[model samples]
Target: MFTPSSALTLEQGWQTTGATGSLQKLKKFNNQDFNHLRTSCLSQGVLFEDATFPAHVSSIGPNLLPEDKLRRIQWKRPTELQRNPYLIMDGVSRFDIMQGEIGDCWLLAAVGSLTLQKKFLENVLPKDQGFQDGYAGIFHFRFWQYGDWVDVVIDDRLPFLNGRYLSVQPRTSNEFWPSLLEKAYAKLRGSYQNLHGGYLSDALVDLTGGVQMAFSLKNPPPDLEEILKAADKSQCLMGCSTSGPLRRNIEVRNGIVQGHAYTVTGAVKICYKNGWKHIIRIWNPWGHGEWKGPWCDDSPQWDHVEPKCREALLRNKDDGEFWMSCENFQEQFSWLYICNNTPTFLDFGDQHCTKWSVDSHISLWSPVLATGRNYSPGAVSMNPQYFFKVPDYDPKPYNIVVSLMQKHAEDMHNAKTLKIGFLITMENSKVLEQFSRTRDITKYFTLSPGTYAVVPATTEDQEFEFLLRIFMKNQDYNENSNFPPSPVLPMDVPRQNQDRSYKAVFLRYTKQDSAIDASQLQQLLNDVILQDEMTSLGGRFSFDSCRGILALMDLNSNGRLTLQEFGRLWRSLTKYMDIFCKEDRNHSGFLDVSELKSAIQTAGLAANEQLLCLMALRYGDAARRIGFSDFVCCMLRLETMTNAFQNLAEGGSQVLMTAMEWLTLVMYT
Candidate 1:
């Protein structure tokens, strides 16, 4: 509970919206400031100033006893609802929430499930708030939106039908937290009408800054018991939904409501006379309709248990809470949404909860002209890329998780959600290795200590804003904000002198006829090679190195290089040299295992353990090493493959690679 003397101004609120700021500098809210902010906002006669409510509310006609139902509507503050409107009644529990009319049981179910975690509930509702003790007509709640916990303020004007709350009701009349929270959420989305229906995972994500994963009951994981144990250990919030078209309060064939969401409150293995029975407890938001099968209230199974044991179950009448066997639960629910609150980093024996450092950027995806695809080339590279540097020497085990979230469409009521997906690749020496695909907005990968590039893109051509999030244990990155750089490669040529020299070298080597034959190209390679340079292999350039360079430069077997083609090759080689020098930390003119990994990653390629091992075996010397010549060979092969991929994008002839060509390219490279 927090009670600030003055509320944050509109501009101040806007500044807090995911702005870069010191964590220590943040004005953290507590029980006292919760009430303070509300009082301050009320005194100013302004709604809570936050992004959720960017503007004033619009006017809409209210109906009493309209066609939908026979009832009148009223608006009231908490004090008006009761003499002592404590934020919560006796205790916050699933029973405290009851769905009212709206098809937002998914959200209400999340609220109900959230109560099981006391700390999380406090973070959202702030126990210090109530109608008494300097009452105000405004209240505030916090929601985890995008990558930040945002404070949303709202007036305590709740809609009531026939003198009772309309959207969501409480089990007890004095318990106003459920209805008030619903109203605040409704206000966040613009209006009460916007809260009609939504996914449970969406609501859970808003309530907790946890990763959401949904499991389809139709193909449940075989290791479900282990997954559930882990989820319980992490205190994950869980909910279930049945399949079928939604009809208000309509029960399906076996007394279970179709298309209704339910909270998974508890899982237990209780002992019976013969053995043990695994039971799972679920609560319906409608406050009615429960499983009446075995393990349920009044079931014969209870007869075997002692009176005290049976009393512990606390079976209640029509409370919308009931226990069914885990087996039955599988048959009843179609989908299960689990909000995993597990810390992304390793737990170092600390009892306190860990909060992940979250950062996000808003960008859009557009169609690319790859594979001869329609639309713009600029759009084809719509994928945003991020670079992460992981030190290779850390002893502790670590992993990285990337999540891609697209903004919600405003026409959610009528329009269907677009199918969105992304792929993550790690930079191998010259090639990008496919790592993970975006699934459930979260993907995990085991990585060695090195710099890695993550590219997230839409599976199809569509323009829409999206958010990318990175979660890692302990790491740092030298972020180069510009991604998908222009093919002209301006960023690579930062030094004017070096650029001029490289260009002069290319001009001097080219024939006056603006082209050179194979012999002249060979002479150019020899000229570029710096002899008398001590190599990691204890010698100067080798015959094999020269041959590799020739094979790489002669892209077309025409035995000739046009000035334009030679220029492209020269630029690519220049870029490669810069990257190679940065990776060759010892100035050894060769790459060891660790150095090779770094070199591959710096080149924007993904390298897994298997791939790294193969590279070491294929290219490393008898001393288990890779010379500069081999490195160049790898780069050329990758460039060739990339060109082929681009040709595929252009709808050109199918790219072909014969076994002999593959062997000749990879064996020596």
Candidate 2:
């Protein structure tokens, strides 16, 4: 199974209001740090070229068409493409990206929808690096992969067909952000050909990392216009797609690209014939296609509108964006996908949309444990299960959105995919949904007050990875820092395996010595514990961490741990793990100050309010949450300090240690 990326998103924090998981940090693709490489290139006076994702034929993948074989594709930099290349000429608009030879309009459709978002567009595409001053031919873009947002970097060498650019083309001759952003995405998915055809929602989720819902236009819901208006007010990304063999991209006379994805930028009603007309603005990713029907750019329908209204609504340009009546939109399009980080437009009667809470969890489908629902119904019991509560604070039923997305390989088109689905079991009743090979499957439930178990499984027993996100309405994200301290109490940690292999493992690390130091202990611990468990247990113990452990457990003050001393340390570690897990309610691998206070108290140790604040400042991350490693270090220091003071104190609080003792304690821990 693919190991989840260790890079957690520091910018997009996990607000654990009603969510079960925290966001994982995003790592640089192939461990290539963009800033570091750019600096190296500048210092050396050379343009940067990414060796990891090199600009070669292999990066384009195999030829998939007859026309594709006719062109001699070569990688070209912006300086080679055009003179005075600007990353953004005028500001980024909705019509910047013009499609090229590739048929990945679905990808561009997603990007076009997000172009309407001016409030946080820079978050998705950071506009920091440009082709000027600090330019090193390197650019970076962030995309939401599965659950976490990952920053993908790429060189400026874009693939060119014959003499023109391949796949994505820039609007203006000098503007290159559109092409560069597309290149970054292509690098992320392995190749340009890998972007051939994909799910619109997949691209949408990657663009916004938000809740996505697709609606069929064939039977357009009565509240379709209402939903669009709400979505527009909520600043959601919306895309419309045409289906059927008739609309299957080959038919162009209707001015609609059949089987094509189009961005729904806005919804408006104009005063035409003194009647309200619901007009939906749909933009073609090709940057040219338009609906040749009613309310189209050059249609006579504009003559009936008020002059000012017509001026505001009509844009008689072949810039790929057009205004069409809702009736025409439903006739030409089959599906409309809407995505948003804040899902205020949902069916729930929510007065304040900000009150919603989202929970996310990432896990693997272990072959041994993932007993799927293929053979029998009861097999689902063996799948991994997660639970959440629906309190009875509101009398109305809450609208809950559950989304499951499978993680794919870098070459996603070639990656293994299984029929995956999830089961929601509540009140002894099981609710099952469609199981398909699609990347994302979402379901909506109007649930009352109760605890529910979400059991995600595949059609068979196999090893894979998936992300589960549950959005519950009315769950306020109350991350209060000044939580009341827990009273001094003790908690139980389940005893772990009692295997005799520890003796052999210990001797192997110590090499039959009576005792071992920090480095030896680190190696021994890392080797003995399984990697997955090690990850859950605050990652592998570092030499520095083990050194602190030695300081805490070395009764002789020698900065080494004897076998017997290691025994006590091991037991305490198991207890700390248990306490950490119990307090870390979101399973985010980190604990806030409130959780830290509870965890410290539960481990048969209590720090006053002042000490807890000090610990939070000392060990917590930017979000004021302490990671597992830091928590362990804090615990060891707390214990050692408490013991040293007690051992030399005349009163409970006063202690006087010798200079040598103080030096040794300060130097080791």
Best by TM-score: 2
What is the C-alpha local distance difference test score of candidate 2?
A: 0.69
lDDT of 1 by residue, 361-460 (tens): 4445555522112223343333454544444544233355566665543433233234454444444331232222222255545567665545555445
Question: Candidate 2: which pairs clash?
Answer: 7-25, 7-26, 8-24, 8-25, 9-25, 19-359, 247-258, 249-258
Q: What digit string (tens of lDDT, one per residue) describes model 2 on residues 1-669?
A: 000111111111111111121123455666677788889999999998888678776677665344555347788899887778988887888788998887777788888887788744666677669988899898998887654567788899988777877778987889988888888888877777667666677788888777888777877666788788878777888987876442135657878876677889888766779778889998988888788888888898888989988888778999988988888888888888888874555733445323455555666676675444543345655666655556555523336778887654333345455667787876435755556566677766677777676878777655666777677665432345211111110121111111122333455577656678888887876665424342245555678777877878888899888765775676566567778778888877788888987887786666666667667777666776777777777887776666566666645655466534553444343
Model 1 residue runs over 4 Å out of place are 1-72, 247-249, 305-310, 343-363, 366-382, 387-401, 408-416, 426-440, 443-453, 470-669
Model 2 worst lDDT window (10 residues): 1-10
The TM-score of predicted model 1 comes to: 0.57
| Collision count of model 1 | 29
